[model samples]
Target: MEALLKAVVAGAALHSPLATLVQNDGTEVVLEPPANKGWVLYTVQSGDTLIGIAGRYRVDPKAIMYSSGLEGIKLKPGQQLRIPLTAGRSDREPRVPPGVEPYTVRSRDTLKGIAARFGVSELELITANPWIPSLDRLTEGAVLHIPTGQKGLLVRLSKGQTLLDLSGRFGVSLLKLAKVNGIDNPAEVAEGDLILIPGILARTTYDNLLAKREAERQARLEAERKAREEAARLAEQRRREEAARREAEAKRQARLAAQRQAQAQTQARRQAAQPATVRRSNFVSEGGYTYPVKSYVITTYFGRRGAYQRYHTGVDFAAPHGTPIYAARSGQVQVAGWSTWGYGYHVVIDHGGGVDTLYGHMSRFVVSAGEWVERGQLIGYVGSTGWSTGPHLHFEVRVGGSPRNPLAYLP
Candidate 1:
């Protein structure tokens, strides 16, 4: 009868076009049933609990425990649990499709502000439209072609730096800088004065002006050589013709000097038109947190694993077992405990404003649950515990009970 039951289950799994049940370690297995089945199997990882795992997956903890058959509701890494796939909908908007309308620069516009408004990065904006100058100078009426399918505007306030300093730093010409900013004179800019910097325009204008200046300089040098030859010929003629020819040679030399001065002025004007580029502070409010360890890579990610039939639920940072873990932000510890389900030792910190963080699979805990810890304070050590395949720390950030992407919060 037992053999028949097993065979029946296997047959049901194979024949059911909507779902497939795979055998797990007697206690846990994934059921990849059809979408209509409405429930899927999730694998538990180190440091996962029925409540925490349920919260991460957006299901009721008690419901998962009961449905998965928990005599004691104990979870083990690689343990599979039944989960309903149709749970919650993420609120993030769909990304804009590529190749949309180009935006022209309006008066008083900054790349940073534009990027923030469009929900895109400043780097993306600059790369999309290469014609805009990279500097903070935007001309009053200069036209800019915006790239298709970009979003966001995160404008930064202009730092009170001189045009000369900015020019050298960003490699833009003074005149191009002035043209972008609509400044008649570069010297008029005062400290604390705000200005819109155009990055692509500065680069293009500077390169073109430098090339033109070099060409003009070469032409002038060639002209001067010919003029010198002509003057020499005139001197020789005057010497042969005696005192009467001296006046004519003097007039020729005077004309050559005036022409050289005019050429010099024209070159100076061209140089003055280009502008400078600069790197402004993108931080408008408080700066974001920095990484605790100098060098650590993510070996595992937060989610469900195939082997356990449950959700993993935390980001895994690979490091030495005893590598110190620091508080990502100033927060009070909430939970610190040991378990068999995968996380051997773990700590959860509650940072105010609905932000809670979890650190799992620790070799040691420096602070007890409920203790206030400052940002960068040593909180725990990394370890290979529970269901971890190797030595690493599983980290998670939770808003209420739902898991969110950690990279979005970190710098």
Candidate 2:
């Protein structure tokens, strides 16, 4: 375990910037300088090895080893290793700073192809164009501003609908295409989708670029305003519908409450009219007669003691005029007529048992003397007439021709 740990530590130390380490057995390990020195930087490309890279940059393998601190000629994708320039070549070409221009996409382009064409690495292209999600899914005919001094070819996919066909035409992997567009499935893309192509190109000098950007901003604002108005209109319509529904429900409830109140009032009147157990005997009598009107309180009795020395033969019932009167029993009207003396309008009913009932001082009589009337039939209306004081019904019960006490037969 100790030996393994020591080997790992020694391997890490070789990559650090320090003097070379030599063992007692004469095993030599070379140390490199820091990569921050002023040297030309090159990014690794696809199919790039240390030998090919060293050959392309015109540097010795041992010199690269001394500068990069690599134990062997191994190169990985996107690795940034410095290229030591010849002393006189320093003033040959100026290096461009990062983020200088936009990129333009072209037909049948790939990151590897673009990097190879522009003498730059795929990693440098990716870094320069951060707006692009991935380099592998660049769309054809889409323009990107290329940084001025960067070296790389911008590869773009075709603008047509067939992504699979476009990928085939461009010689780019389908997986890379999906990665660039953030599409989990490559089959989901249709035609005419815009994709970013990674490349370095000469910057354009178009003067209307700022105006075009402003126009796009204005268009976006107008769209948002229209959307908000439409949403508000729909919300107002919904509120009006809700209010109408509530009003209809309230009206229905009010109608139901009115019906329920009417029913309760009817029930109370019925219950009040029922005879209590204690008052039942008071309403009954041994005689067969019932009162002509309900609650027929006597205002005047049969006999009268007055200054004129007269006698009153009938009982006067204090009641509202036009109150319904029933036949004393099943009977026929004997004499129904109007008179000016004592009775103004009167109705006489004769029962078969030689008993007769007289209703006098009536406003009108509904039955004539020849009319065959039944018990409880309304025969006349009460009134104050023919020497009467106020509205009252004059009632008289006679047996065989003589007036009798009405209370003797009333129930």
Candidate 3:
């Protein structure tokens, strides 16, 4: 063992926080703190061997040798030895108490199911039948022992039902339920495993059976409560959305109506010759503004119109989603982001002649505000953003911040 420790000291020290002790066969063991009971001092008696001393103390001989620091198996009278008392029940094997009866395991039998039926803990059942290999995988037709003295209804645990929850439903103590199932960790209990309850009968004639029915009803109520809460939350969200939509629409309509009234009043002024002070020629491009998008059919014409909406400020062009939109004419971009008032992801461009062109409902933009763009330059893509029904482009020609027909300016 000393040689083994030396061989692994370097590697083991690098990996583990605990002091590792490697055996000769390359098996490693961690050094744990001394057991709670600690060690007892005993004097070597006449004809006492290391093995015999270990047997007398019900401890491993190696533990005795290691604790005593004995180099060899040889022992002398009056030689001192330290016998370790394990922290817990290391020497004693679990046994069923008297009055327990043996039960034959039937097909599809589980340790939890057997213990629940017998009103005992799965641990107690397992403790009584030590010959059984595993708790998770029990064999059919295997004999098991029923622990003595239990009173309760045997019920299989349901999915998502916690032991604490079950205990409350059945009027059983939580600690007792945990104790019976050998469940050290309540969180680790297997779903659908049968477990025992004390003082509850499964028969319908008993009042305890009513507890089970009540529990089921309570579970259903909880589910329904959650569902209703979710539905109410969704409804509230929709209501707020509709309110916002109506408010935006009203504002848009009022703005458009004012623009139309202003236009009507200014119609006579425009009929006269162009003002000498106004440099309208500088604003006019060599060629007039072109269509922003190709292969688009006019859906909603510019002016007061539409079934759902009162006023149409711009012309709506039906275009496929992600269709490229171009600049109507050379201009500097002014606005190039989202608009909550039904004009989402729009851009406003100021052409020289107090005429600003607006493009609304775009999927994405290639240019930003304050950037110069050329005529027919790729500016954005068509999308059904804001209060649009389908993928389309809302094209507007704004003359001095007032809406104008885009078709009148476009070539």
How many residue pairs clash in all the candidates, one count each? 72, 16, 2
Candidate 3 Cα lDDT to native: 0.69
Q: Compare candidates 2 and 3 on lDDT and give the better one.
A: 3
Error of 1 at 97 (Å): 99
lDDT of 1 at 194: 29
lDDT of 1 by residue, 229-314 (tens): 99999999878787556777888888877776575455435533434211211222143454444345665445644331456576
Error of 2 at 371 (Å): 1.8
Best by TM-score: 3
Worst ten-residue run, lDDT, model 2?
198-207
Candidate 1 regions off by >4 Å? 1-288, 303-310
What value does the lDDT take at residue 189 in candidate 1?
67
Tens-place lDDT per residue, model 3, 1-411, is: 676455445333222224566676878787753334556677987656676556445579899889889988888999988776654423222222234555655568776787788777755554444445555566543445575755444454566778888888878788988776667777766444446675554343323324545777799999999999999999999999999999999999999888865664364244223322211222334357778887676666777642334667888777789988988888999999999788889999998878899999898888999999998889999998887767988999988888988767765
The best candidate in terms of lDDT: 3
lDDT of each: 0.59, 0.61, 0.69
* C-alpha lDDT (0 to 100) for residue 396 of candidate 3: 94
What ranking emerges by TM-score with the best candidate at the front? 3, 2, 1
Give the Cα-based TM-score of candidate 2 against the true structure: 0.30
